[model samples]
Target: MAIAARALGPSPYGPPEGGLRNAADLIVRDAVAYAGRCDPRVSVSGEVVTGGISAVLIGESRRAFAVVLGDRGLGGFTGLLVGSVAVQVTAHARCPVLIARGTARENGPVVVGVDGSPHSDRAVAFAAEEAVLRKTDLRAVHAWTGPASTRAGDMLPLVYDPELVGEDESRLLSEATAGLTERHPDLLVAHRVVRGRAARTLIGQSHGAQLVVVGARGRGGFTGLLLGSVSQALLHHAECPVAVVRAAEV
Candidate 1:
């Protein structure tokens, strides 16, 4: 489905005869045409509505499998990689929100961040389905940092065994993706546990990835925060499309 939202306001000359509607129609028409070219067998529909674009899209997202949006919209500054509308919709959308950015490799694997959080679990599930649909492999990544690494200038150096930390993180990755192969018998799956920040690690992985999927909010996020740092970072800087999936109850 193609949707275009136009906000109409009072004008001294009154509404310009069919101007908003015509522009909206053209936008949706072009979108439908492009979709038709992408897959001739798929049925396409269009809708032109009058309201705030983000609100309209968010409302429609309730029934959508996913809400796909460009990283930046028409109103943003040229230098802004992610627009306000994209961020708002991504945060509030009921289903997965896929933000299209740099050109996605047609054959790259679907990469997902796995942190053993419920939100991360949902993201893994979403990525698994996407990988199966694309007939590509799924790569689940879990990134971690030493306890003291995140802190600035400490009085005492915190000591921990790197080997044990690595082992624990590897186990976490395994547990996070334990049943993926059983659920998707034909889907290929790979696991990676790296010692680094989640966002940076996932961004590096995205370089050759067709899609990067991450939970809207990770384990470290505040309850009131709709979008987490890792998800936001990918949305702004990933090399391909980024899909942010939110847990059903969260």
Candidate 2:
């Protein structure tokens, strides 16, 4: 089903497009090639009205995976926009949403942010799969700090050297990366442990990344049309496109 886009609003999925051009076609093609056959694809084009939009979109694409062509204007007034259109689509869309700025490439590792939450494991699995597909490394990162982690650090070798913060994080990173290596024996996987917010650390470390993978929600399972704040923050802020994996429910 294709929508002429007579409108655009809180639709259930990404929009279908028409009147395509070479640049858009190439981008769509490259992203598809990078994502491969298992994933869905949708090309989104519309006249963004800075702070507002037409409030309705037609067509539901194959599986609602959208690549929105955003202009420079939306970046400035992003504050006025709640969580950003990209974020909204990534969070609410039925399937995964790939919001890209430039063409896709299979270079950087699929970096996933893990917080020891069940959702984090799902994200790690998602990242590992991406690494397998791209023939690249998987960087699974977990950041922990503050008082709650003190005793755990004392007992955990990775976090044992509290005074040696660098060493502490190294151990933690190793622990997280171990699972990835076992699952995808052919994959080259790595991990990092930092001391800060999950979203900020991932964004900072993945500056030149190919893709930043994350979970739609965590154990807390926060509310609203969007997922957790970290997922939302990453969608708006990450330098590279993001792949958010929501935990599969029984």
Candidate 3:
């Protein structure tokens, strides 16, 4: 089933009640028509909810498997308004949140973030399933820094070698995706280890991707922080759709 919703709020200027209703009706009509024609077997519903957009959408997402949102702005500034809503929902919703960027390529690979965290494990599992559903290749990316850089900026940068760090990161990435490809025998998987800021690297890699999947919280994310910086960055800047996957319910 597909649900198309418009969260309404009081507007001081512009349309009156009747005009607003007409506009809402037109929006829903177009949405339903497009949705219906997309897949005949899929059932679609249109709704207009009165409240803050974020809260209304988050509430509706509780019973949904995933909440899909569109990137509001154009190419360079994609998700200007939608980023806030996407982050809010992804941080608090009980289910996964999918932020679809306007610049996404429908036929590209699915990129997934990996850092060996439990949250990332869930992300990988979800990405694997998504790759199967989309019938695309899955690219697992792990970003890591050298020990010297890993330390706070206050500390002097040590001239350390990345040989050891790279080896360990490779091992961790392999361990994280060990059984995933086996589980989905027909799925093709690729792994990469990059050294840099996690968010920037992921955003750059997302340029040609159809979708980017990341954990709601990662290794560096504190428990109190609602969402990790990497995931938050992807919501705002990824070229393709981004999926924020939370840890599985116990």
Ranking the candidates on lDDT from highest down gives 1, 3, 2
After superposing candidate 3 on the true structure, give the runs of residues whose Cα lies further than 4 Å from its correct spot: 1-19, 73-83, 148-160
Reference-based lDDT, each prediction: 0.88, 0.61, 0.82
The segments of candidate 1 whose C-alpha lies over 4 angstroms from its true place after superposition are: 1-18, 147-157
Q: Candidate 2, overall lDDT?
A: 0.61
Residues 1-250, model 1: lDDT tens digits: 9886545443447755446566678899999999999999999998888778899999999999999999877788988779999999999999999998986899999999998889999999999999999999999998988642322344533788888878878888898898988999999999998889889999999998999999998877467999989999999999999999999986
Model 2, residue 46: distance off in Å is 16
Highest-scoring model, TM-score:
1
| Model 2 Cα lDDT, one tens digit per residue, 13-58 | 5444532343346565765665564455643343322223212211
- Model 1: residue 16 alpha-carbon error in angstroms: 9.2
Colliding residue pairs in candidate 3: none
In candidate 2 the C-alpha lDDT for residue 142 amounts to: 74
Error of 2 at 31 (Å): 12
